[model samples]
Target: MKVRIGVGHVPVGAHDPAAGLAELADELEAHRVDSVWLSDLASAPHTVDPLIGLAYIAGRTRRLKLGTGVLILPGRDPAVVAMQLAGLAALAPGRVLPTFGIRPAQPADRPAYAVPPGRHAEVFEEALTVVRALLSRPNVTHHGEFFHLDEVSIAPLPAKPLDLWLSGRLPAALDRVGRLADGWLGSNITSGEAEACRVRIERAAADAGREIEPDHYGTYLTVVLDDADERAVGALLDGIRRRRPDGADPRTLVCRGWAAAREEMRRFVDAGLTKFVVRPAAPVTSRRDFLDQFVAELGPMET
Candidate 1:
């Protein structure tokens, strides 16, 4: 398997992350890493807006693929997000990859501007169609259950069609990805489970008469340097446990050290999922320090 590795994170400390993202992008590019991804969490004051943050990094680097591990699609206007992505596509050319996901249901994590509780799926499905039409057509008119558009269109289309990837592991969500998405970007699932999901997605793709690249299947794996601060591990798990409640051993979910992380990567590759984005599983005093060491350690392992 030809594995590709990338790194992403929720910016925890940097007050202004534009310079920081740019610097990190530069480092990733220097190490010949496949991409640099950003996690989108608009409500988190500590996190930067993924789209805006990526634009800054795009301007600074020429090679690293700037991606959203998963951009929330339920809360915002699809036309607006499509326009922003379309503009970035022009500026950055063929190096943009977007992965779509739903917003958090928890009250505190929900964006100040977001779809109502329990109605996100409805809005997201409609808006995703709107985005697809707008990105592919010079004139798009959509009148769906949750959105309305009349002969509207976005300018400066991407040099190539934008392939929207989806992130999820539930049966319904996996089927949706196979039917509507170009690829998958799952997380927190075991290799055996990932293989099962891949089978389901393949069946869905075949039924839909669409074929995706073998390499587009990917996942986000939480990783922390073995020697990272103990207090940091506790803080990180607190945040992660809130999102992952399946009772899988946290150690199984996280790569505790460089050797362990690489071994886990190989297993995922054997499972037919090679594209990966590793995010720190613990808090750290220096984002740069963590990334600097990570990229260097991971460089020798990439195929």
Candidate 2:
């Protein structure tokens, strides 16, 4: 299987988002990196609107694929997102990969969507259907519990298909991915866990008379390169708290250093996962320095 790596766009502090992304898009291509990704966080200060940032990156560079770790797909108009993605696809056809996620029942974030927390599942499914339909054709007429459209359409169909991927480790989410999404983009789970879940997904796909591409399984790994694991863990705890399953600490999920991170990728490769999006937890103090370290150390390792 072929291996591909994508760098995640995560700002640390006091940085120009555009400059940072432009530099990253260039460096990623220079390093032979396969793709670049952005994290969508409306509440977090370190994140940016991935749709906008990724589009900017797409315009700045050629041959570098763009992606999102997980774009929240709830509590918004599916038509707006459909139009935006269609526009982005027009700019960068096969190069764009947008993964959708139905966010959890967070009180602060839930209110903005207006849909009850309990109904997120149904709404997410319907919205995804609408977005898929809108992206594939010039016009779509859809009627669902969350969205209603009358022959609405977007211009400039993508040169190639914009395959939608789903990210989540929960059982219901896994089943949803198998039944609906074109691929699975997961996080917060180990390689062994991913392997076991792949079986479940395959069964669900069979039940649904659908199939997921063999090499589409991937995970979003947050890597912390620091002097000590404790320091790294402390810095990342607040951000990944929700992702830390059971009683697992931040250290259990995040890579401790360069060697550990490479080894983890090898483990994932052994588990039959070939795609990865590695996000750095530390600040991008120097783009050149960060790219040098990331490319030299964390670039795809031979298995």
Candidate 3:
């Protein structure tokens, strides 16, 4: 398998976010990191809007692939989303990687991504359909329960069609990836779980009479430096616990050092994951220290 590694959005604590993001983008480009992913959190004050942040990064760097780790799709207008992606594709060409999710990450923020009651899944599917149509077709007429588009067209379409990737670990979500998406970028799951999910996706695609590309399975891996400060480690523990309250030990899920991270990456690669987004478990005091380590260690592992 061809392994491609990328950086996830690292929190810019106590720094000017605009400047921090610019510097981070520049450094990633300088170091030749494969890509940079922005998380989508609609209500979080600290989080940057993925599309806008990506556009900014696109301007700052020439070779970096820009991604929305998982943009929420049910609440947004698909046509508008398509237009934004088309613009980005026009600007960045083959570097726009969009992975969409059915809902926001947090329950409290779910209301902010408002869709019809009990119809979030349906709305997401419909919205994706509309977005795909608008991106690839010159004139699209889609009539669904949630969306109605008549002879709509988005100009400046991508030179090549954008590959629509999806996120989620549930069985239904895995099946949907086979039926609709061109790739999968899952999160917060073990290598064993990811392997199983990949199997389901392949089975679904076969049943759908469609074939997904072999090298499109990817996942996020959060890691911490072994010598990281106590506060940083504590924050990382708390964040993972809150995000996953299902009693899984944080140590089992998070890599404690560079060696551990490499071993985990190897396991994931053996399990059929060819793409990775490695995020810091917590905010670091020195971007250079973290990035330098990233380059010295995981960077060489890229195929």
Q: Could you estimate the TM-score for every candidate?
A: 0.91, 0.91, 0.95
lDDT of 3: 0.88
Runs of candidate 3 with Cα error greater than 4 angstroms are: 14-16, 242-246
lDDT of 2 by residue, 68-113 (tens): 7788888878889988988998888778899998983244554556
Which regions in candidate 1 have their CA more than 4 angstroms from the true location? 10-19, 105-107, 111-113, 285-292
The candidate maximizing lDDT is: 3
lDDT of each: 0.79, 0.78, 0.88
Provide the lDDT at 22 for model 3.
84
User: Can you tell me which runs of candidate 2 are displaced by over 4 Å?
Assistant: 10-19, 104-108, 227-232, 300-303
- Steric clash pairs (candidate 1): none
Cα RMSD of all models vs. native, in order, equals 2.3, 2.4, 1.5
lDDT of 2 at 195: 81
Per-residue lDDT tens digits for candidate 3, residues 47-111, read 67899999989999899999889899999989999999999988888999999999887777798
